[model samples]
Target: MAEETITLEVTRYRPREDREPRAQAFTVPYRKDWVVLDALNHIKDRVDGTLTYRWSCRMGVCGSCGMMVNGVPKLTCAAFLRDYLPGPIRVEPLAYFPVIRDLVVDIEDFMGKLRRVMPWIIRRTEQPLTAGEYRQTPAQLEAYKQFSMCINCMLCYAACPVYGLSPLFIGPAAIALGYRYNLDSRDEGYHLRQPILAEAVGVWQCTFVGECSAVCPKGVDPAAAIQRSKVAGAKDWFLSILLPRGGRS
Candidate 1:
């Protein structure tokens, strides 16, 4: 069976050349199961070679190839043309980030925000030379496994309304990653990070529009993490007044 052709309106911007951004259209053929990545490749190869976009791991695991497809952040390789109403699909770089070019936004803002949270596990002691690997129970794995699924795709940031308003919100993805490690029982950094996690910008800024979880490809559920932090912060205040030593050890 032959595939159908569709039109894609891509936004283009060159800070060194153009004063502002402009939208350009390209028509390409596509199969029902074929993702937007196929049409982009066709347009880039047969139509315009200068178009800029990022992609890797054609599968959804890499979290690359994330772009705005008709005002929604999604992985191009996962966006099927058949999913749209009809032709004339609009493609653009993600919102809440500076556009470096067509469909390519500056990720530096996201990287810096993630770094501030220290997304990796911090330990004070090194593993013993003769010690075996760390053992984790099924329940323990279940506790933090969902957060481990984040691919750092920035889709959460794109969907987060807080990020759109305040660039310093710390956003959803990074906070979710931080929560993943903080929940690990083996991590001693949780105590040192308690104040960090309890900050105003940490997770309290999340408004829970829940768009972040809705758009997450890996089902990381950043909205839920933020909500969990909010609950914890609220409970801690009460525990401090009602209990001894502010519920500290």
Candidate 2:
């Protein structure tokens, strides 16, 4: 019997060689257990040594293998070939970002946004080493745990049309992470984070498209986080208007 095979339509872009991205097709033997990343790896090792992409910790933990698989943003490591079966699978670099090589999108934008959100525990004053460690209950841990699961897969960014249209938008992952740190019992950075998040291009830029949450591999609901932050910002504004001395005690 002839071996079953699958065709992959992968987007190829070389800065000096091509003006725009172009699709390159390759045929590989089909295996139920093989993923899209595996197919790309086969192409790299056996057929085309010049194909460039990024992948590490193929278990989907590193989140470096994210790509547009059949127009949906996904972790190529988790996208199985069996799901598409007997045909071509369209693979491309993530949308709304500059493709440096083949499937690799430049992540400097996301890195900058992450830093702007201050996604870390902040304290007005650090306690002395003699003090005991900060602790929390199960409920406290659960509050921010889901948002913390984000591995920076960037599938959310690819699925977000807002970010696609407006590159300056602070974006879902950054806001969701900012909310996560705000929810931390040990954090007091909400006031600090609010300035950036409450800016015109922050959470308000999101039209509640919810595609970010829909495509999140980790099940983190970034849309909800953004809406919640909006509510918090509004309440803060309302308080400032209604109370004396600017409402900030």
* Top model number, lDDT: 2
Query: lDDT of candidate 2 vs native?
Result: 0.93
TM-scores across all candidates? 0.93, 0.98
lDDT of 2 by residue, 84-155 (tens): 977799999999999998888899999999999999899999888789888899999999999999999899
| Collision pairs in model 1 | none
Which ten contiguous residues of candidate 1 have the minimum total lDDT?
188-197
Q: Pick the candidate with the highest TM-score.
A: 2
List CA RMSD, all candidates. 2.0, 1.0
Backbone clash pairs for candidate 2 read none
In model 2, the runs with Cα more than 4 Å from the true position are: none
lDDT of candidate 1? 0.85
lDDT of 2 at 178: 93
**lDDT (tens digit, per residue) of candidate 1 on 155-234:** 88888888899888888888888888888766767666655667887777777799999999988888888898777777
lDDT of each: 0.85, 0.93
Candidate 2, 192: how far from true, in Å? 0.5
